[model samples]
Target: MTMRIVAGIVISAVVGVALAVTASYALATSNAPDREVEDAITTGNLRAGVVVEYGTR
Candidate 1:
């Protein structure tokens, strides 16, 4: 019984670590825009009062 509980705790910890690593990797390699694109959007918005949604574009 104690061994089973310890094994469960170890398995849960390993899974948690794996999930955390995967999440970190996903966030690190996300599809966020670069500086030029952001600058262009900002410029357009400032020049023409346009509202550009990044996700839509």
Candidate 2:
């Protein structure tokens, strides 16, 4: 009976961890496009500024 209880606790913990990881990954992918857009705009502006500065020299 004690072994069965321990086994049940271990199984529950593994399942809980799996659910948490899956939920976080789902949330991250869902929000990824906004992050990509922000990054692209910042990188593009930086690159353009560098190019113009070098071109002027």
Candidate 3:
């Protein structure tokens, strides 16, 4: 019974770590961009100032 409890705890910790890592990776690799900027580009209304702002970043 003690061994079973220890195994359960270890498995739970590993699963929790895996979930945290996956969530972090998903956020880090996201391709979504700013909606307003995307709309401006799509409509051919993008401004020079916007480009400069992004460039400085």
Candidate 3: 10-residue stretch with minimal lDDT: 48-57
In the range 7-56, model 1's lDDT, one tens digit per residue, is 99999999999999999988986877886679889866464657556754
The superposed Cα distance between candidate 1 and the true structure at residue 6, in angstroms, equals 0.1
Q: lDDT by residue for model 3 over 1-57, one digit each (tens)?
A: 999999999999999999999999889768677776787789798656554345432
Q: Which candidate order results from sorting by lDDT in descending order? A: 1, 3, 2
Q: What's model 1's TM-score? A: 0.54
Query: Please, what is the whole-model Cα lDDT of each candidate in the order they appear?
Result: 0.83, 0.78, 0.82
Native-referenced Cα lDDT, model 3: 0.82
Cα error, residue 19 of model 1, in Å, equals 0.3
Task: Flag the better candidate by lDDT, 2 or 3.
Answer: 3
Q: Write the per-residue lDDT of candidate 2 for residues 1-57, one digit (tens) a residue.
A: 999999999999999999999999998889677754686697764644343333232
Q: Compute the lDDT for candidate 2.
A: 0.78
Supply the global lDDT for candidate 1.
Answer: 0.83
